[model samples]
Target: MADPVSVDVPHKLGREAARARIAGGVGKLADMFPGGGTVEEHWEGDTLHFTLSAMGQKVASRLEVFEHHVHAEVDLPPMLTLFAGKIREKLAKEAPKLLE
Candidate 1:
């Protein structure tokens, strides 16, 4: 295992709205991964954080929505080095789609 990679994404909505979008995005991820693990949600001020854990490995991500944009961070698991790029691409495509 190696150090985790952090990914930040931006959303165009408020905290609550971003949270909802994140929930849906996570659900999409769960479906995409299937039995991979679990997704957890958290809140801090206007930021919505999500953590995904599975097979003893975990990925911590965050979504923050400001007045004009939303910021998101996705931490890559060390074990996922090989598939990290693919996973990021998939998430990038799916996350925004879920918000819609």
Candidate 2:
């Protein structure tokens, strides 16, 4: 938990709409990681709990859907903290396209 990297992806879709799109987009997330790693996802109310394991690292994340935006937080292990900024950037850049 090296200061969880988080990003807010703005969207016009309401909470429910955003949640639906996110739920459906979970599978595609694997593509974002090399080796198409394992991704386990579960929805808890308005938040999505995710765990991705790839290249000997485990990345946990949460996405909370709101009326105007979806907030994403990723917990990278110490070994991956060095790339936190890049991860945040990629998420910020790609989430909007996923929702659209």
Candidate 3:
């Protein structure tokens, strides 16, 4: 395991709307990745737990949905550390659309 690539992506759509958007866009979300991994989501209270696996690596994240923003902490495997910056950059660029 490596230090996680954490991000807080703000969304104008409140918590409920954000959650609905995420839940409904699971397939589109998967397609964002090169290999299109499987997505499994579980909720604990207001936090959404997500696991995306592909090419033997798993990215686990906890999304805390708030009234005006969504906070996410992502744990990336050690092997993927080298691409952390690129991954974070891509996520930052794509997050707004995903949350909308």
Among all candidates shown, the one with the greatest TM-score? 2
Candidate 1 local lDDT, 1-100, one digit each (tens): 5544344555667557766765656655554332357777777876767677655676776766665555555666666676667666666666666556
Instruction: Please report how far candidate 2 places residue 78 from its true position, in Å.
Output: 0.6
lDDT of 2 by residue, 13-53 (tens): 89998898988888777666544488899989999999998
CA RMSD for every model? 3.2, 1.3, 1.6
Model 2: worst 10 consecutive residues (lDDT sum): 27-36
lDDT by candidate, in order shown: 0.61, 0.83, 0.75
Off by over 4 Å in 2: 34-36
TM-score for each model: 0.66, 0.92, 0.86
Q: Which residue ranges in model 3 land beyond 4 Å of their true spot? A: none
Q: Could you say which candidate leads in lDDT?
A: 2
lDDT of 3 by residue, 1-100 (tens): 6778777888888888998887776555555444548888898977888888745787787778888887777787777677778767866777668776
Q: For residue 50, what is the lDDT in candidate 2? A: 92
Query: What lDDT does candidate 2 reach at residue 26?
Result: 88
Query: Candidate 1: lDDT of 38?
Result: 76
